[model samples]
Target: MAVITMIEAQKRSGRFNIYVDGHYAFPVSDSVLVDFRLYKGMEIDKELEGRLTAADDVAKAYNRALDYLSHQLRTEKEVQDKLTTLEIPEDTIEQTLKKLRDFSLVDDAHYAASYVRTMMHTGDKGPRVIRQHLRQKGVGEKVIDDALVLFTPAEQLAVGTAVAQKLAKRYQHNSTRNREQKMRQGLMTRGFGGDAIKAMLDAVDLTPDVDEQHALLAKQGEKLWHRYRALSESERQYKTKQALYRKGFKLDDISQWLADFGESVD
Candidate 1:
């Protein structure tokens, strides 16, 4: 048996160091000290000391979890990950998570819904992108699916159109075909499905006028001309024609430009 020789407050708030047999034993939160009614001259056996120590660990783990949650809404897995990184024992982490759930502080469903809303309204993200982000954050599939119910097809089209329109404006200087292609690639990278991308493309007026087409052809053609300047004239024309073809320009347009530039076709 060991006798409590002293109790002293720690420099950190809400914690105290205990002394047993005139030597330092352990530090515990104020709540743990009060719950265990620790005081000087109290006698404790090894088993009781172990129990108090475990209880103090639980209290500390719970407090740390609370502090982590206080800053923002967190998914259960996110909270678990943070506690695990802190090196809290598994059983204590489970207990802390249970308490948090009971108090409605950590709920995956709620977190998923809020996440979807924020991404749609503020981040301008589509459902697929939002779902991918939630999955990466360790939210369950069912929870993610349920949360995505809020993003209806009509709503998705609206958001997709808004995103596509912005990109279209940004690429207004490019040819119609190049601008449309860029817009599609950008939306695909952002996780919009093919159908959604098609819908957005169909809605946008991407047709270039005669002047715009001529300007784009002149700009791109000059670059290609310089690149193939070192090649034989015949090879240069063939390669430049192939290059412009791959860039979504019609063959007729390329032929017309070649003729206007006084380049003879084989």
Candidate 2:
């Protein structure tokens, strides 16, 4: 209980200069204090309790970040995004990522593999689409390629089937030409192989008992394909030349597929 002597309380420009034990104490920034009476000596407890509370708050925030990351695998970008969302400072994020990396908790390689596995099973995606997705997730090219190696031919078939089924359902229309063009573009956009798509297209019976528009379009497309397919050897060669380009087929593959159509190859 120290007696704080207020020796000279000078009324300054906009505040009262508070002196305790003939020495300047903390500033009384509030103007309301001027209304009060101050004598020669006053008692003040200068106990700094805020220091302890501030330290505890800082520690608690860091601990929360650590606990949040312990739950699952996270990419470096994902972890950094989360850290930013949590309002953690950049320095703290660097520290947290380092700590996480040391623990083998935030490895991009492991995360990429797990992501590929999950996407393969539920997302029903091919290598190209999955690679793009992983790239957006901040995975490196080598890691993406490593993950892609796991996609076997059987997996590619499943992915192709999934995308083809979905697209075939939507692109069925009154105009068979429109439906055919839309499906070719759609399946290609979904990263399915042309051969795989051709097989799927051939296998699906577009005509069903459900709707007349679908049956009509299916008949029209079938009629056109048959007409185009049954042309004289020269006419067939001319149209086959354009089919590959229309299909977005690779130049090498296109040249190879139509080699016998109008080529000098014996």
Candidate 3:
């Protein structure tokens, strides 16, 4: 580790600039080497000062990634996953993560809370659904529980209520008993819980509700209808009974709904 005192600087070529440190030091890449001695009789070698500068550059890249992340609310796993996908070095990614945590920039807990808040404020999404989303985003159960502060019974019920009302209006045509069951199935599919859905449906007036059960019933009808076409004339009646029964349709309702479609003649 030789320390040289830079004395003067002179231009040697279009790309070469020599730094005179009592003698002459030539720039080779990022490092400077002095071969001639001017102060007494001494020669030395020293590594370039690019090491610290390189550290700074890498730090900036990490900061840039964090900055892009902070421009929006990102889940912790989501950001880390992205950096991993970008092939950022593990050390650099760790350094960036530490800095972000220090600045309170990537709190998974905060993100969970924020996500729940946003969903509740916008529409009738239940806590169960929101929790699943937060968990998928790498938020822990503890953090999600903490974030569930706002989704009280009434709040949750309100969500169920809103969704049920919309469903009722949308499916007002579900005249048969199966209509209610199908709506219940749909709410369950949407991640609303049984208790919430039961409470909501119990509160809702089915009379004014639209026939949401139509699509499901119609889909079942299409399947049974297809099977009815495939059966030979003799087996037609038996197959229609078997198909509609397998489709979970009410024996009487199937007969009633499709009667207008007319039966095939032998």
Candidate 4:
């Protein structure tokens, strides 16, 4: 057994420095002090001292966890990983997590749902992208699935069509096939599924009329013409035809443009 020789308040708020047998022993938050009823001249056994120390550790760990959560909403795993990084003991971390969850401060389901809504409305991300992002954040599969239930097929089509229409307008200079292909690739990259992309492409008007095709040919043809300017006329014609064909122009369109420009494939 040891006698508590002194109990002095520290400069930091709500903390106390305790001494046992005339020597500094440990520091504890006021809550711990009050809970244990520690006072100068009180006698305590080694086992009681050990229990008090453990209790103090839990208080400190809980405080640190609260500080971490003060910035933004975090998933349970994020908080667990952070506490682990701090080297808190596994048992203490579990206790701290229980406390946080009891207070509803660390709900993975709520976090995942909020994240999905924010990404869908503001960031305009698809379900696949949102799923991947939630997975990376350590949200459980079941929670993510439940959260994604809010994104209905109709909603997916609405978002996918808006994105596809934007891409179609941007690439209007390309042939219909080329414009559709680019739109598909762009939607897929943004995390839209194949079915959604197809639906969007089917609904949008990507066909290039004669005037649009002529405009595209003129714009692209001028560059190609300059590129093969040094070649023989026949060779330049062959190269330009091949280049336009690879760029998704039809054979009839290329042939007419070549004839109009006084160039022959032969």
- TM-score each candidate: 0.87, 0.51, 0.64, 0.86
- The better-scoring model by lDDT among 1 and 3 is 1
Local accuracy of candidate 1 as per-residue lDDT tens digits, 69-122: 899998888999999999999998898888789989899999999988887777
Q: How does candidate 3 fare on TM-score?
A: 0.64
Better of 2 and 4 by lDDT: 4
lDDT of 4 by residue, 158-212 (tens): 8888898889889887876687789899999888898788898888876568788
The root-mean-square deviation over C-alpha atoms between each candidate and the true structure, in angstroms, is: 2.6, 13.3, 8.3, 2.6
Question: What lDDT, from 0 to 1, does candidate 2 have?
Answer: 0.61
Better of 2 and 3 by lDDT: 3
Q: Higher TM-score: candidate 3 or 4?
A: 4
Ranking by TM-score: 1, 4, 3, 2
Off by over 4 Å in 3: 1-54, 208-266
Count of backbone clashes, every candidate in sequence: 0, 3, 9, 0
* lDDT of model 1 at position 201: 83
Worst 10 residues of 2 by lDDT: 48-57
Candidate 3's error at 197, in angstroms? Answer: 1.1
> In candidate 3, what are the lDDT values of residues 1-266, reduced to their tens digit?
44444533335321223343454554332122232322323334453434433344445546567667867988767777878887877776777777678888888988887877787778667777788888888899999999998677777777777788788767555444545777787678767787888998987787632344445565666666676787775476557656666655566655655564565322
TM-score top scorer: 1
